[model samples]
Target: MATAYISTPLGSAKLEGDENGLNTVTVLEQDEPESKIIPDVLIDAAYQLNEYFEGKRQNFDLLLNPEGTEFQKKVWSLLSEIPYGKTLSYLELSRRLGDVKAIRAVASANGKNPLWIIIPCHRVIGSDGSLTGYAGGLHRKKWLLNHESPSRQQSLF
Candidate 1:
C-alpha cells in the first residue's frame, strides 16, 4: 500500500491506496510527510485534488476503491450520480435507494464516504434544507456546495 499527504481547504489529508484503487482519505490536523516515497498514483491524486480545490475541475476521474459495507457501497455509488452544483436530501437519497426508512443508514454511509469530492457525499443535506453532518466538517461542506453553485449567490448590486 502507498500513502501520501495532500493539502486541501479543510486541512492536510492523507491518501492511501494501491493498484486496486484508493482505499482511504483521512483528514489530518497538520501536514505530515509520508515515510515512503510518493507514488505516481498518489501524486496524480494530489494534482487532481488541487485542481478540484481551485475550481478548475468539477469531476474526478482518478481510480478509487473505498472500503465499506455492502450497504455503504450502494449509497456511495448512488451519491456519485448526483450532478455537480446539485444537492440532495438524506431522505431523497434513501428513497432513491428504495427504502425511505433507510435514511439513517444512508446518512451513515454518506458520512463514511472515503473519496470526498469524487464521490460527492457533501451533496447530501438535511431534509429541512439544512447542512448536516460531514466528516470533513460542515463549514467545508458549505464551502464545497457554494463553490459548485456560485450562480446561486445574491448580488448586492
Candidate 2:
C-alpha cells in the first residue's frame, strides 16, 4: 500500500491506499512526516481532502476501500450521502438503514468508520442535536462542521 500525510486546518491526516482503492484517511493528533513519494491514489485523496478543508471542494471523487463489517460499511455509505453542511442524528441514520431500533448499532458503526472526513462520519450527531462521540475528538468535529456550514460564515476573500 502507498501512503501520504496531508496537512489541514484542524490537524494532519494520514492517507493510505493502493491500486485497488483508497483505504483510510485518519486525522493524527501528533505530527507525522509527509512522504516524498506518494502513490497516485493517495495523492488524489490528499489533494481532495486539502481542497475540502479549504472549502474549495464539496465532494470527494476517489475509489475507496474502507475495511469494515457489512453493517458498518452500510452505515458509512449512508453517511457519504448526507449532503455537505447537513447533519444527521444516529437515530435518523438507523431509520434510513431500515432498522430504527438499531440506533446504537448504527452509532457504533459510525464510530468505527475508517475513512474519516471523506466518509463524513463527523456529520452524525446525537438525537438531541448535540455533538457526541467522534473518534477525532469533539473539538475537531465541531471545527469541521462549522467549516462546512452552509449558512455562509462570511467569506475571507
Over 1-157, each residue of candidate 1 has an lDDT whose tens digit, in order, gives: 8888877777778888899888787777676764356687677777787898888988888788999999999999999999988899999999999999999989888998988788899888888888899898878788888888868475211
Candidate 1 stretches with Cα past 4 Å from truth are 33-37, 152-157
Q: After superposition, how far is residue 122 of candidate 2 from its true place, in Å?
A: 0.7
| Ten contiguous residues minimizing lDDT sum, candidate 2 | 148-157
Q: lDDT tens digits, residues 53-145, model 2? A: 778999999999989999999999999999998899998999999999999899899999989899999999988889999999999888888
- Most accurate candidate by TM-score: 2
Q: 72 in model 2: Cα distance from truth in Å?
A: 0.7
RMSD after CA superposition, every candidate? 2.9, 2.8
The collision pairs in model 2 are none
Q: After superposition, how far is residue 17 of candidate 1 from its true place, in Å?
A: 0.8
Candidate 1 least-lDDT 10 residues: 148-157
Residue pairs with backbone overlap in model 1: none
Q: After superposition, how far is residue 71 of candidate 1 from its true place, in Å?
A: 0.7
The TM-scores, one per candidate, come to 0.89, 0.94
